[model samples]
Target: MNEAKIFSYGSIPRKGDRAKAYLYFKEWVGRFFEFDGARKEDDVVRVVLLASLNNGYVEGSAKLLDLCGQTVRNHLRYQDPSSFLQVNHELVDRMKRLGALSKPLTLAIDWHDEMYYGDPEAEGVAGTRRRRGSHYAYRFATASVLLDGERLTLAATPIVNEPVIDHVKKLLTQVSELGVKVKLLLFDRGYYSVDLIRYLNSLEAAVCNTAAVSHKGVEGRRG
Candidate 1:
């Protein structure tokens, strides 16, 4: 049998003890394995036992097992995530791996804007009328959840107009270089234009958007 050896030393009694220790080590290796990125905490000691009967090692088995599988499972998820999921399923795994590696998610793209208030009192005191109050109107571009279910601020910019498609595409290209994939988008109707829709489709981005009625296509130009 193919076996790997590990040496452990301590003040021990006899040759028989060494044999028993090897048997225990071999049995442990044969029976179980740890996942590559999983972790267990001491918080569950009241409900679960983590100490080895032979040795006083303290660790949660299930958590270790899960971590062992995390790396492979995340890789698989990134390769082929089901489209119906609202969040970028693949992105989560990548984030987990990044966390395991002690890296942080760095923001990319020019995300302009400071607040997302529709009330007039909240508008900036002195500002450009084209965008008026905030840095820029959130609806002017395509928007997606950078990190969802968290308290989101309006300081982030969205995919605003078809005219800026090249700019947005370049930003996405930069993000992909960091090994994270952008898959889903969320935005408002004002960002809608034929070109923008086509661009989003080209990126294979499943988008959630508010619909805009184009005046050019309706009766009397459908105003």
Candidate 2:
């Protein structure tokens, strides 16, 4: 008997396959967002998604998406803030539909400090102290859901000289508008304050936080 012959072939994904996939993705994104700009919607979505997936740099996204860097930069540079907020609101709605707000959920609020080496007088710049010590930084307060071993950011607001309690109240109000009932809030020591606790209590949400060491020491002395 003649020996049986066997053949194997390796198939690489075609560029057309990638293009088709991107088209489908763009269609889904379009269902939730509508870009109103000089750049084509497809191109805008491609650049924004690609840039997000690639460390948020236009040059890297352009190289990966086979577009000119300057073109990607222009699209981003000219993107309207209102359009971006509309898109974000749509995403948040979708997230709520995914059962993110179906029930009372534990929420975590914190401040993210981004170091800025630029001039201290720059607009939107504020002084913040981090592990690297005091520096001019842009601070943003973020509220996130702690669900099923994952944290999903729900809202973020710039914190330029705003009190932490006020920022938290604003975030809670925005989250409430999304129909989410916050069951509890977890905060860091930096956010520990009687006024903040009272505010959260007024919202009928349980609150937990790490007591600042200095506060603890003062209380100990008073005792």
Candidate 3:
């Protein structure tokens, strides 16, 4: 039998013949968890246990539905080499109906200044002093346009401290596989970077409608 990975938060089972090592991934801490079989590497076997933490803290064990099992599935399929990914707009619509998602597929490299809560009457309803509001660095890819001028989309979680390069890489990898094509990417003056532009170009994606005044040559033109 293939070695299996046992997942838990605190410690390994004491009575088991061998201890299974389960590490907590930064993305999935408390929301959902699963056991995956081990893979052979040289002379040893290694297994990965993934978990998604709930948005807010609770007294006891999280309810089964509180965890994002589909998120876990997406994560696993993404890691597989032979798998193909597709982002369906219909699926996104269904998620919206279920109130699991909101829309506006923009990526934010910086932090926002707003407060999020499960209850409107909760004590701290105003903006927090500790953290800014949530923003999207990268979100979903879809066959159909998910966001319209009247619609605003949102990310599942706030993306902070992540470089644009890494975000771009992940977006290109997953979105392309999902058959979602973006004709142009528009951004403000703050995102202007020669390195980022060049990288996007390498992937055959153009960086359109970026502020041009930062260049010395452009400055001369204003005169």
Model 1 agreement with the true structure over 26-85: per-residue lDDT tens digits: 443321223333342222221122233222222334354343333333333333222312
Comparison by lDDT, 1 against 2, better one: 2
- The superposed Cα distance between candidate 1 and the true structure at residue 29, in angstroms, equals 41
Q: Rank the candidates by TM-score, best first.
A: 2, 3, 1
105-134: candidate 2 lDDT, tens digit per residue: 777777776677668898888876543554
RMSD of candidates 1 onward, in order: 20.3, 11.0, 16.9
- Residue 32, candidate 2: Cα error in Å is 7.8
Query: How does candidate 2 score on lDDT?
Result: 0.61
Distance from true position, residue 89, model 2, in Å? 3.0
Model 2: residues with Cα > 4 Å off, grouped in runs: 1-27, 30-44, 51-74, 98-100, 130-134, 204-223
What C-alpha lDDT do the candidate models reach, one value each?
A: 0.35, 0.61, 0.34
Candidate 3 vs. true structure, TM-score? 0.31
